[model samples]
Target: MRRRPQKPRPTGASQYRINHQIRIPQIRVIGPEGDQLGIMSPDEARDIAVEAGLDLVEVAPTAKPPVCRIMDYGKFRYEQSKKVSSARSARVEIKTLRMRPKTDTHDMETITRKARSFLEKGDKVRFVMRLRGREQAHISLWITKLNAMVETLNDIATVIQTPRIEGRMITATIEPNNSSSQSSSSSSSSAPSTTTSSSSS
Candidate 1:
C-alpha cells in the first residue's frame, strides 16, 4: 500500500512541532536553560529532552538546520497566549456617539458622559449627527450643537476635526487632551529662555 503524505503543519506564532511531531533529520538544539547543545539528529535531541523531562520543540524551523529548544511546552504555550492578549488590549480604537440636530439637553448630556468615558480610556471619539428631510436644510443647527459638545469635553479632549457635513450626517473627531498637553509641555521644556549679561569695561 502507498503511504499517505503527512498533512502540512498549521502556521502561526502559537504553532510549533514538539517531540515526535518534529519530522526533520538534523536540528540545532538549545538546552532547557537556553544553552546551545550544538547540532544533532532529531533522535538525539528527543533523548536529551526526555532525560531533562521537557519537550523538544521546533522553535526556528526555517533555519539552515531547523532549531529545536528543550522547554516545558505547556508553559511556553501559556506565555504565548498572554502576549497575544496583551497586544490586543493595548490597541487603540475609535468609538462613535450618534446624535440628532433635535437631541434634547438631557439626551445630549448622557451621550457626552459616554463620550467622556471613552476618551478617558485613551480612545478617539467620533461624534455623528444625523439629519432627516427638512432637518438637512438647517445644517448649521447641527454644527452649533457639535461645537457645544466639543466645549463640554475640552478638559479631557482636543478637537481633531471640526464639524463637517457629509451627506445627511455631520461628523467631528476628537482625541485625548493628554496628547496635546504632553506635546506642548515637551516643546516648552526643550526651548528654555536664555538671559545675556553685559559687562562694562
Candidate 2:
C-alpha cells in the first residue's frame, strides 16, 4: 500500500522559536560573520540583535562565557533545515541476510560477500542463521560461523550484536566501524552499482 507523504518540516520562514524559551546570563555576542562583539548584558545583547535586524540566539549557554549569535532567525533555521534534509538523504538502510543450517560452504561464502557488500554501503547487516529439526542441537556450529563471518568483516564492519540463539534461529548484526569507514563502505557499494548501470547503458 502507498503511504501518505509526511508533512513538510518548518523552514526559515516558519517559526524559528518552536517551544523553546531561554533566559541567558552574560553573553559574548558574535556578529553574523563570526566577529566577536565582547561581553554584554542581556538587554544590551537584545539591543544589538535589534539594531542588526537579527535574533539574539543563545548559541553556547553552557560555555564559561555564554555565547550568542546575531543572526536572521529564519536564515539560521533554513540552514538547519538543509542540514536535516541532507542527513536524511545520506542515510543508508539496514539489510538482512538469512541462511538455513544446512547451507553449503560456497553458499555461506556468497552470503558473506553479500553481507560485506551491504556493510560497505553503510547498511547494518542482520545475519539470521536458521536451524531446522535436530540441527538445532548444533547451535555451536552456527555460532562458530557467525564469529568467523564477523572476523572476516573486521576491517570493514564490527559486530553490533553477539550471536544469540532465538527459538529456531540464531541472529547477529554488524555495523560500520566509524564515520570514515561508513563513507568508504558506501562508495565501495556504489562502485558495483555504477559499473552495472554503465554496462547496461
For model 2 the local lDDT of residue 177 reads: 73
- Candidate 2 per-residue lDDT over residues 1-201, each given as its tens digit: 222212234545433321123355566878878999898776787666666666667677667677777777666767877987766636656577777766777877888888778767666777787777898888898789778877888898877688898888888877777644456665554431111100000
Q: Single out the weakest 10-residue window by summed lDDT for candidate 1.
A: 192-201
lDDT score at residue 198, model 1, on the 0-100 scale = 16
RMSD (Å) of each candidate, 1 decimal: 15.2, 13.4
Off by over 4 Å in 2: 1-85, 89-92, 179-201
Tens-digit per-residue lDDT, 42-84, candidate 1: 8898888877777788899999899999887777877977987
Cα lDDT of candidate 2 equals 0.67
Which candidate number would show the highest lDDT if scored against the true structure? 1
**Candidate 1 segments exceeding 4 Å error:** 1-27, 31-36, 39-66, 70-86, 179-201
In candidate 2 the C-alpha lDDT for residue 128 amounts to 80
Residue 139 of model 1: what lDDT? 85
